[model samples]
Target: MLCFGIILRHILYQKKEAMFWYNFETHNFETHIGWGFLSAFYIASIFALQVI
Candidate 1:
């Protein structure tokens, strides 16, 4: 899972859309769809590991 996440992050980074963050100056959120999906995947994988 970790390896996959790393690879996925790398690809997303190369595409210039890896993670999302708040834009404090604009008082809005910046969208980075890839990170959202990646985060969900990581969370689910961690939960599954804990269950098993």
Candidate 2:
């Protein structure tokens, strides 16, 4: 998970220019909230799969 996070962060950093429109248009709070929701959903799905 730590390696995944590091890779994900690296990819995001590398793709910053590609996402300029999104970054420019969205407020920081909104971006953070979106990421938070995505992370929560990812974690929930992992747990759900484990249960199954």
Candidate 3:
């Protein structure tokens, strides 16, 4: 489970462009909110699966 979790995290981070400083400030606030919502949605999906 730990390995699978790490792999999922790696895959998600790999596609993201602004992982650090410079591009961070350039992006709009809505972009960050969208990412946050996406992350939350994935997390909730995982939890729902576990519950089932």
Candidate 4:
């Protein structure tokens, strides 16, 4: 019974850690893409307005 409890706790801990990493990675990706698109839009607008 004691061994079973330990195994369950370890599994839960690993799962929580994995979830945290996944969420962090997803948020980072979203932030990067959002900023990239925003910057690109501004740059394109500037170029277009320059009439070049």
Candidate 5:
């Protein structure tokens, strides 16, 4: 996706339509906290109990 965006901008710049390459910046930092970490820790704990 990053490569595609860069290529698109390059093409627009080559055509001297640099203004077309301009885009609004947006970012979303919301995410599920500990989604993977907790799952992995749970699995590892279970495995450790089995080994013991």
Candidate 6:
């Protein structure tokens, strides 16, 4: 389970930019919240979790 979680995280981290484009085209939830806050929260969460 832990290994799977780590792999999933690595995949997402590597695909951040590509996912943004996909989301943009799909008109996903971020269209409402905007990327700035999401990025800030993502960064803060990583820092808070001591992941970096």
Provide TM-scores for the models. Answer: 0.42, 0.45, 0.47, 0.45, 0.36, 0.41
lDDT string, candidate 2, 1-52, tens digits = 6556557656755555445556567656677666666656656755665566
> What local distance difference test score does each model get?
0.54, 0.60, 0.63, 0.60, 0.43, 0.65
Writing each residue's lDDT as its tens digit, candidate 4 over 1-52 gives: 5555456556655755565577577776765565556556655655564564
lDDT by residue for model 6 (1-52), tens: 5566566557656667776887778978855356657666666755655653
Candidate 1 lDDT: 0.54
Ranking by lDDT: 6, 3, 2, 4, 1, 5
Error of 3 at 21 (Å): 6.8
Ranking the candidates on TM-score from highest down gives 3, 4, 2, 1, 6, 5
Which one wins by lDDT: 3 or 6? 6
Q: In terms of TM-score, which candidate is stronger, 5 or 6?
A: 6
Compared with the true structure, the alpha-carbon lDDT of candidate 4 equals 0.60
lDDT of 5 at 50: 55
lDDT pick, better of 1 and 2? 2
Which consecutive 10 residues in model 2 have the weakest lDDT in total? Answer: 12-21
Q: lDDT of model 4 at residue 26?
A: 79
Clashing pairs in 5: none
**Which runs in model 3 stand beyond 4 Å of their true positions?**
1-13, 16-25
CA lDDT, candidate 6, residue 24: 79
Where in model 6 is the C-alpha error above 4 Å? 1-15, 19-33
Q: Name the top TM-score candidate.
A: 3
